[model samples]
Target: MTVQNILSIPPYHYVHVLDLNSNVQTLVLGPKSYVCKEHERFTCEPKRMISLSPTEYCVIRNPVVTENGVPVVDSDGQVRLRMGECEYRFHQDSFPLYPNEEMSGGVEVLPVVLADSALRLKARCDHVDTDGTERKAGDEWLFEGPGEQTGSSSHINCSSVRCTEISRSRLLQCFIDYLQFETRGIHIFAIKNLSIF
Candidate 1:
């Protein structure tokens, strides 16, 4: 067998890939254990594998909707999904399952839950906000809960916040912040919902 075949993931499994735009796509492996993206077939890379417990987790590809509640469609005639935000779900039984192996249940609404842990993400490329704020690559950020957070001006019910990482250190500085809160007698909930992107 070729290198691609040898390194391919098993059939019916899924691989989550993060593009430069910060969008995560769940590509399903075909029967041949290859992923087809934009007409290109390739093997799944090790870094793209997201370890999720099948019993407790599910993925939701929520559609990108406008302020008026209209769904946004891409030039390719496909509905643009908010892949970055709806990648992981804490509950698997919230939605009905498909008859077969599918990465997501298509576009549907699900109740957002306060996760046990926040998701840590790394920027792959430079991005600019609508307000002209520029974010550089290698910057780490956190996407936290459906609950309230204090002492942060940019807090939203569930949103991304810029976080700092110690240079040359693979450790996340956010965890240190949480530990500090704990030491100060602040009750920090256990973060079992943590996912790295």
Candidate 2:
């Protein structure tokens, strides 16, 4: 599907499955899933963000497909490697995973690599399959645009990005359905730990 328009979304929480490989998939994180489902980890919510600790935190360790110039390990290809998860750093921000070859349609994921940092931020809207459930794990997750770019592998060293193009519902959905939280509730600790200029 090609994206003609994108909307801005507010953050919420849900349990999302990370399609690791063709046959094997892993449940990454979701606020709703953790509280309701049985997992090996403990979680807590701080402010609008959900933090995940390692008790039940697990990385699927799988291969990935790249979109535009960014490479993400998610079903959509936009991801942030957890802080301690890899040698390369992925921020604790909301991320999307997009399929490959989507820079041609009307809708596209826009990513900006900062001039002073290695950080990358991605923002996209639904263009193809509206059926999130029916879309399956491997289906392409984007629209198309002439000059627009797909999301990034893992957003890096950056702090903020304009999420105005993404819908509030979409943003909430990603958080409720996609984040693996070490802890949920007020992210007082996370916020306190931030680097202040």
Candidate 3:
């Protein structure tokens, strides 16, 4: 990813600088004034008390990124959750999942909940083009939609399953169509609802 693609600002907000430490020899970047598609990951939080599909799962965790061991902010200046190497940015109000090209078909991943212990990192929109002008929204391409959770989990309730990884056949047989419905080419399915006969 180019430097331009690595830095970006969240939607509907302008970058604001909290403080700058010129005295310190080490580089301490201020809050996010901009967001980059290459450097940042964004996801909307799921509604509470909602039942989700078996094929669908969620990751509830604390943020990994820290500023002086604190949380980070998005382009909108909202606190973010860091999982692994990814920096997931969201807002206090309803956030949008963007659409994009190079998209494929798969089960829709439901929203997730972030724990309270995550650190808050700030960003600034200091990024500009060669012409020395602020970048416009249309200039970039970011994707928002139902995204799948792709990390290891410790909350599995099944005693027989030793690892998180399982074959499609095993999953289907275990759930017995209660958790999913069969699709011709798609072995794994996520359903909206199920009614027992």
TM-score of each: 0.24, 0.16, 0.18
- Give candidate 3's total backbone clashes: 30
Residue 74 in model 2: shift from native, Å? 12
Each prediction's whole-model lDDT (CA): 0.39, 0.29, 0.30
Q: With candidate 3 superimposed using the best TM-score fit, by how many Å does residue 112's alpha carbon deviate from the native?
A: 16
Model 3: lDDT to the true structure: 0.30
Better of 1 and 2 by TM-score: 1
Mind giving the per-residue lDDT tens digits that candidate 3 earns over 70-136? 5555555445544332222322232212211111222335333233221111113234534354443
Ranked candidates (TM-score, high to low):
1, 3, 2
**lDDT tens string, model 2, 1-197?**
22212222234442223233333223333333232222222222212323332221212223233468455455644443333221211334443322221112222223433432232222232223223323222222222222222233332222332323444445322212222212223222223223222
Q: In candidate 1, what are the lDDT values of residues 11-111, reduced to their tens digit?
A: 44443332323343433443344434443333335322233333344454442533564555556444455544434444232232111223464332332
Q: Please list all clashing residue pairs in model 1, or write none if there are none.
A: 116-191
**CA error at residue 171 for candidate 2, angstroms:** 64
The true-versus-predicted C-alpha distance at residue 187 of model 2, in Å, is 51
